[model samples]
Target: MRCPFCGNLETQVKDSRPSEDGAAIRRRRSCQECNGRFTTFERVQLRELMIVKRSGRRTPFDRTKLERSIAIATRKRPVDQEQVDRMVSGIVRELESMGETDIQSEVVGELVMKALRSLDVVAYVRYASVYRDFRETSDFAKFLGDEGLSDNEDT
Candidate 1:
């Protein structure tokens, strides 16, 4: 690695440690020329995963976009922030396990739906309504009918 201080090409690693997330290696290095010390982090560069939309359009995967949607759906709900964080982490893990650079947006949505369904029914419905673009009340009714959720669960 090139030294950041004097653009020296030679450097020696003084120490190394794994980052808390375990996704990267933190290394302390000293420049051979200037004796300047600096820290460098090395992380595995994952391949760009393309999200294939329902309209056959491909877009880059965005974590913030996913978080925002889930957050909006979970607003005013009893679900804790930790649960949301875990749900997001689980989805990322599942996606990474696919071992493919390209994934369908529908697949991501379905994963989130399944996770949210067991976590909070209200949040699940909110997310589904936005995701499915429910045109009328009948759409929600159909979902309720299909899932067998009724007024009894509301209390």
Candidate 2:
């Protein structure tokens, strides 16, 4: 592996282990040139997945983009990084298991909303407002009501 710190071409793996979830392999490595240490993770790619946008445009699925969106929703909430990661992983696994090369953007959004609903209510609302395109208070009210969430639950 190439060393990220010094751009060295040579690196030695000092340790290797499966990640906590066993979905990936974590490797600790040191650059042979600078002796700098770094960690790397390897995940299996079941297949190339594409996202079908609302505009009917198809694009390759991006994991980082999904993570960023979820992170924004969970920001400043009690949700920890590990939980966010697990949610992302779960979504990805579900998508992969679907065995479809192309998936609707709405499907992905709904999956995120569902995951956030269970993780944190505030985060769910935050994500819902943007995903559902809430323009008025009534939109939020209707969404809460449809989801069977009472005002008391938000507190």
Candidate 3:
């Protein structure tokens, strides 16, 4: 592995173990030139995936982007990094298991919504506000009403 600190091509793996979720192998390495240490993860790639956007544009699927979006949604919530990582890994596995190289953006969004709804309702609402593109308070009200986020009893 290349050294991220000094750009050295030579690095020695000091330790290797399965990740918390067992979805990846975590390796601790040290650069020969700089002697800097860092960690890297190795995961099994079932296939090269592509995402089809709403505008008909196609782009390579990025796990970082998916994780970042989920992280943003779950930030300051009770959800921890392990849970988020597991969720991301599970979603990726599901997508790969679908046996399709090309996946729709809408499908990805729905998957995130479902995962968040189960993980944390506040995070779910936060993600929905952006994903659903709420324009006003009424939009939130309507969404909360539809999704059962709002209280059922009258004041």
- Per-residue lDDT of 46-149 in model 1, one digit per residue for the tens? 66778999899999988779878899999999987768866876787788789998899999999999999998999999999988899999999998888888
**Per-residue C-alpha lDDT of model 2 across residues 1-155, encoded as one tens digit per residue:** 88999999899999999987777899999999999999999988898999999999999999999999999999999999888878988999999999898999999999999999899999999999999999999999999899888777645
List candidate 2 stretches off by more than 4 Å.
none
Q: How many residue pairs clash in each candidate?
A: 0, 0, 0
Query: Which structure is stronger by lDDT: 1 or 3?
Result: 3
C-alpha lDDT of all candidate models, in order: 0.86, 0.93, 0.93
lDDT at 16 for candidate 2? 99
Tell me which residue pairs clash in candidate 3.
none
Please provide, for model 3 over 15-54, each residue's C-alpha lDDT reduced to its tens digit, 9 standing for 90 to 100. Answer: 9999999999999999999899999999999999999999
Candidate 2 structure lDDT: 0.93
| Candidate that scores best on lDDT | 3
Candidate 3 yields a Cα-based lDDT of 0.93
> TM-score per candidate, in order?
0.69, 0.92, 0.96
- Which ranges of candidate 1 are over 4 A from the true structure? 1-46
TM-score, cand. 3 vs. native = 0.96
